[model samples]
Target chain A: MGFDWAVIHDNLPFLMRGLWNSVQLAAITVVLSFPLGCIVALGRISRRRWLRYPATMLVHALRSNPLILIVFWFFFLVPILTGRPVGDFASVLAAFVVFFSAYFAEIVRSGIQSVRRGQLEAALSTGLTYAQAMRFIVLPQALRSMTPSLATECVIVFQGTTIAYVVGMREFLHTTFLVTERTMRPVELYLFAALVYFVVCLAGSIFARRLEGKAGIPR
Target chain B: MSDPLVSIRNLGLRYGTFRALEDVSADFSRGTCIVICGPSGSGKSSLLRCINRLEEFQDGDVVFDGASLRACRDLPRLRSEIGMVFQHFELYPHLSVLDNVTLAPRIAKGKPRQEAEETARRLLDRVGIGDQAGKFPGELSGGQQQRAAIARALALEPKLMLFDEPTSALDPEMIAEVLRVMRDLARNGMTMLVVTHEMAFAREVADEIVFMDKGRIVERAETARFFSAPTAPRAREFLDRILHRL
Candidate 1:
């Protein structure tokens, strides 16, 4: 079984479409979840029980469950409840949005916590309101600390886009599967898919590390 | 005599089950400098924080500028009028020294950028860190950072200043630089309530020296009298211990 370059070369266009779908899923999820995560993180640490309890439970609940299960739930349940058939892309995106937001919430919560307590006190004593303090002082510092962790989470979300395959979305993995079935070259196609994921995620990790080095707190 | 700028009456504070302050009373008259000295956990910092309502008290009241802090509707406004410097110079590390000094004025007072920068520059110069204005806090030495923190506090043009062991975190060599800036502020007649262990600064710059032990004011007297003849045995012991270390 010689390695077949012909199949990949012929199907490059078809496979690129799947790759584009994966990229879109990851990019949209990252954009949407980052802010959603920040809000949830704030709720988790809020002084009021009313805000804190539900946020804490939502994060914990989502984190404990598998990502694929959420994808299944959104795929099966959203249409039944809404009485309208949502597209496969929307179903998978919703699942990723809900699932990754919990992880991001934890990351952001820890980042916010990492800022010195004295920073908040200093800001407050300067006559800045609580909102002003968080916005100008705390969040800037917190976001800096969050970068490395956030970058790692982004890579995870990108990789997790593979699970979109189960929901019948023609993302990278599903496209690879279809190609392998058609060409009877499962091993070659799957290996190429893994290579693509590795390259993207590894680049993301390196970029995150460089950013972390630049923004890390001095001792 | 002018009315006291800050009047603390029977102030008591508790953290969980532990009492951090109990029945602590004092008066800080306008344009006067009062130095508070005490062992760790003797409620000096808590008392200072209580003046600005940074810490809630279970008993008594703090009246600042003839208005009760407990009853004051606008805490942010009250805090703007009273500047506090912490032991650790909590300069916003993400900001330039200039921005750190200008933030409160621009945000809290709604001062225009040009106006706030002018005041911030003047304050940075006043603290002797004018040249370091463009630098981030992490790039400056501890003394410079503390000085910048002072400038930041002063940019609000606060009526009263609180120093919570401002020199405690500085290097031994850096301590004098911070004390010098504080001495200058005292000489300029900025109403100050300082919690510190610098006996020399207390004797030189303080109008009154207050000594606390076990959450209560142990001795309060004119600086010369307190240093020369401490009435309380605890005050005498503390002075002896601190002086011996020096």
Candidate 2:
């Protein structure tokens, strides 16, 4: 019935905690998954069937299944199997890690493959081993070419963290849901949450644009 | 007088079901410049790539110096001894000219950074692109990039150098600069196998001319005799077709 400034003032600390958890989850997921994504990318492109098959299967399976199911599986099944208590945040994080890593692996795989065959041949003929060539020559050039796409993927991934709410992680959306249910102000609280998400995504987009500009990647 | 620096016996290569090279045999002495001229898809590039095992072969073997490449367990070790320059230059786009030349030396040979830098600088200077060592490949002109690529190959101090149409991708005006570098390399007694279309450079710089067609050596002889009085009718015809353009 009314825009309640009082409720907004009252729930500031709770919302801030939720926001911090969201940020922490995103930060940890990105740091852990980026290197893992590169390894998955390499494994997907590996010449050996032993390495490529399982990597490809993992990516495909994760991509096709629902992210919510992944969260449920990690939260409900992981503890039963490991017989150790998994933290709530860790469960949500594991799910996000699996989902985003598959996406990033595709990005890196396509990026690495976009480098021409002649480039590898030239480097090999110049006496560099495959590892040396990939490290210094191929990946650097490929990562350059893939910058714009990679930036866009990063933004998508940052926003995708909203799915962490399904696993009972108190992210931005979950905080909004909790505040609305508690105070009976669904419309106002949800609007504020949407605004927060928009602000984050916008800031991330701006930062990515700056990175592309500095890296000299044309839009 | 001594054993061939690069020797191939009955070399055959197949891609899937298609045969790219068949029963091609040759021996290249050290410090000699050999030109391989052929029509498109006649195995000119394949032949050069085979030397460094860039393109794997199906039959027979490639012997580099005294070692059999086919039998050797480590291909990277053998490749280090054979330097190759490509038609497209294929310089790494993200690296400066200096880094492009020094990467293999530092990584593959485990050379110290100072030594690698020194060797890279000397090679850059030798190839006439010392001033552009800090420039990325996309920032340089086509001719300058190709020269940098050559310097990259030379930084390894290879026993043999291979050129696959080094000048073919350059602009007409730029071709002479790359050819000049090639001629200089030949004059320095760096054993080379060049697959090129520039007949003038071939006639002037090549110690021997090898004419290939249908995946086999049609004819090979001293540059003068091959260009002036060819042995095979195919060589004469190929020469007649390209030479009259000048």
* Consecutive 10-residue window with the lowest summed lDDT within model 1 chain B: B1-10
Instruction: After superposing candidate 2 on the true structure, give the runs of residues whose Cα lies further than 4 Å from its correct spot.
Output: A213-219
Cα RMSD, each candidate = 1.3, 2.0
Q: lDDT tens string, model 1, B123-182? A: 899889899999889999999999999999998889999999999998999999999999
RMSD of 2: 2.0
- The estimated TM-scores of all candidates read 0.97, 0.95
lDDT per residue as tens, model 1, A40-75: 999999999999999999999999999999999999
In model 2, chain B matches the true chain B with a TM-score of: 0.98
Model 2 chain B: ten consecutive residues of lowest lDDT? B91-100
